[model samples]
Target: MYRYDEFDATLVAERVAQFRGQVNRRLSGELTEDQFKPLRLMNGVYLQLHAYMLRVAIPYGTLTSQKMRKLAHIARKYDKGYGHLTTRQNIQFNWPALVDVPDILDELAEVEMHAIQTSGNCIRNTTSDQYAGATAEEVEDPRPYAEMIRQWSTFHPEFSYLPRKFKIAVTAADRDRAAVKFHDIGLRIHKNDAGEVGFEVYVGGGLGRTPFVGPTIREFLPKEYLLSYLEAILRVYNQQGRRDNKFKARIKILVNSEGVDGFANLVETEWNQIKNSGVDLPREEIDRIHAYFASPKFENLSGESKTHKAKIAEDKEFARWARTNLAEHKTSGYSIVNISVKPIGGIPGDISDIQMEAVADIAERFSFDEMCVTHEQNLVLPHVKKDDLFAVWSALKAVDLATANIGLVSDIIACPGLDYCSLANTRSIPIAQRIAERFSDFQKQEDLGELKIKISGCINACGHHHAGHIGILGVDKKGEEFYQITLGGSGAEDAAIGEIAGRGFSSDQVVDAVEKLVDYYKNNRQDKERFLDTYRRLGAQPFKEALYDAA
Candidate 1:
């Protein structure tokens, strides 16, 4: 993790003082609700349906034990005793008092964290793969690039107020764990034929009222010109993107209207003028950022852990968790452990204050004093020793944090929905809870295999409903909530927006509908095919028929 320099510390402290004054002005009636809207949004404070919400940015989803403990402290001191992890790998406090927000910001600054750019129409937090440097398959660690962008975009006067909020994601792994394709700008780091590293840049991919997979504007951009190229793209969007209608303001809408070729031409023309400008990252600067993300020291253990193998054979519960929640590490003696926040029948991504502190303790003790927040609403102890797996699992179990459903059906991604969000039409948490409860059997979930269920309370797609293998969207009809189902959507390397099955289901009927679709796939799938694979082979017709025809 990167420590804040003097300049960074000064900037954040000044911003907090500024926001504190602004908050006081609003409370004193010097600024009305409309007047305070932009100021509060710039600081990541939102007036939700029930109370004020504060969204704290977890840059590229990486955090140290110190920062994690601060989050636990914030959750305990202010708000309720828990915080909700967002699909963008941020955390949200849904019940903060309006007057307490400035104090919260001050506390966050002490830990080198802030809530800036989390809610405004400016550039939001740049996210990346949770297993960035530790995973075995990455072409290069992408966090340094993400950090560079974060520095460039933070309070950049040119892009402070765009037509709509912009999101950027980067991934270096073959598997797109960051869901880069669904971002406003997605960057894939890879090596070229000549073995030089570069980026595959995708623009205009987003999901809201309109869903799109952003087209690649450049097949390969030299690593040196990364910042310059990004500047060019943002310049093009800032000058020409829609401003008349809020609904049509996103860059995705602009990309759709101008076509990929036209947009690419504009960006390339802008890039040609600025490609060699001073904004182009110098080699030393890049190296400096890269140094912050260099791998931690690992003992030279030449083989797999004998104790780990024995433990798996001895304890069925630990064995089940290991099989589902662990990923291979580049280091032979270490494993990447994913801690599921989505316990069976619990609100997806909700971690209590005690759980946060417990995980932070475990991270310090077992995972090199670091933790990561996954886009799928889970936590990762990226470098756990294989020999200490049982100890870590036992610690997590004591805190009620050890649930083995990482990618299974019960590992749902859901938004706050009507419970807190003013823009939501229905409740998303209950739907996720019902579905998880219906499929609580761990054996059954594993047997069904790799089913991703995402739910959004509205069409905004905050839960990334468009990217799930089985997506559920909540819609309002005649003042009543109804759930709509989509099948075959995926947020992987081969990304696809799910297609709608048919008519919507009542709240009472949605869970059973999901069950039917799962049963249909289980009965029809070819040998060991996942839900997504089977859906692709059989198409949506069978699943649609299974959901609607049987209803």
Candidate 2:
């Protein structure tokens, strides 16, 4: 993790003092609710259905063990005894007193984290694969670049008030775990034939009322001009991106209105003038940032872990957890352990204070004091030694965090729909719970194979329903809850939007409809093909037939 420099520290400290004053004013009536709206939003405070909700940024989904403890502290003191990890790789406190927000910001400042740019139409947190540095396939760590972007975009005067919120994602591996295709700006770090590292920049990608997979603006953007080229794209968006209607405000809408070629041309023309500017990355500066992300001190050890195998064989429950929760780490004798938040019949991403403390303790004791928040809304102990698997699992199980459903159907990604979000059309959490409960059997889930069942409460697609093997999108028809299903969608290297399977299903019919679809896939699938592969082979026709067979 990149520690805050003097400049970074000064800026955040100042912002806290500034917001403190603003909050006092609002409470004292010096500023009316209308007057304090933008100021509060800039600080990540939201006036939700019940009380105020504060969203704190976890930049690029990276957090130190200490930072995690601080967040848990904040949750314990200021808000409720729990926090909801959002789909955008941010942690949100659902209940916070409006007056205590400034205090919360101060606490976050101490950890080099903040709520700035978390809300508002400005550039939001730049996200990446939660397993970035640890992923075996990655060419290099992507966090240094993500941190660089965070510094540049923080309170950027030129883009403080864009037409809508801007999101950027970066991925270094061939697998697109960061959902680069669905971001306002997506960068895939790659090396060309010359072996010089650079980016494959994609622009005009986003999901909302309209969804668009970004187009490549530059097939290969040189490493030197990363910031300069990014500035060019933002400049174009600031100048010409839609502002007349909130519905048509995202960069994706602009790209859709003006073809991808036209948008790319505009970005290129702007970039040509700023190619050799001072904004270009200097080698020394790059090295300075990269130093923070150097590989952890790893001991040379054999791939085989007799201790781990022994434990797995000794305990049946531990064996079950080992099957789905553990992942291959870059270093030998270590594994990336996913702590699934989506226990059957439990809320998808809500973690209580006890669970938080348990996770923090495990990370400190067994994982060398580092943890990560995954985009799938799960917690990760990024570097757990294989020898510590059983002990960690026991600790996690004590806190009810030992669900062995990492990528299984029971592991669902659902947005805080009508239950919490003001933008949601129908309740998503309950629907997710129902789905998880529907597949309560662990062996049945494993037999079903890897399947991503994502549900978004609305068209904004916060849950990334469009990218799921089986996507369920909630809609409202005459004030009644309805869902639209899409199949064959993926957010990987071969990214594509899911086609709607058929007509919408009412809330009452949704679970059965999903069951029908899954059953159809299972019956028709050849060999051990996954849900996605089966969808690809047979297309949506068979699923549709099964879903609406009586109709």
Specify the highest-TM-score model's number: 1
lDDT of 1 by residue, 92-168 (tens): 99998889999999999999999999988999999999999899799988999999999999999999999999999
Cα lDDT tens digits for candidate 2, 345-460: 99999998778888888888887777888889998888888888888998999989999888899999999899888888998999999989999999899889889999999998
Q: After superposition, how far is residue 491 of candidate 1 from its true place, in Å?
A: 0.9
The CA lDDT at 417 in model 1 is 94
Compared with the true structure, model 1 gives a TM-score of 0.99
**Stretches > 4 Å off in candidate 2:** none
Shift of residue 145 alpha carbon in model 2, Å = 0.5
Task: Assess candidate 1 and give its lDDT.
Answer: 0.93
**Each model's lDDT:** 0.93, 0.88
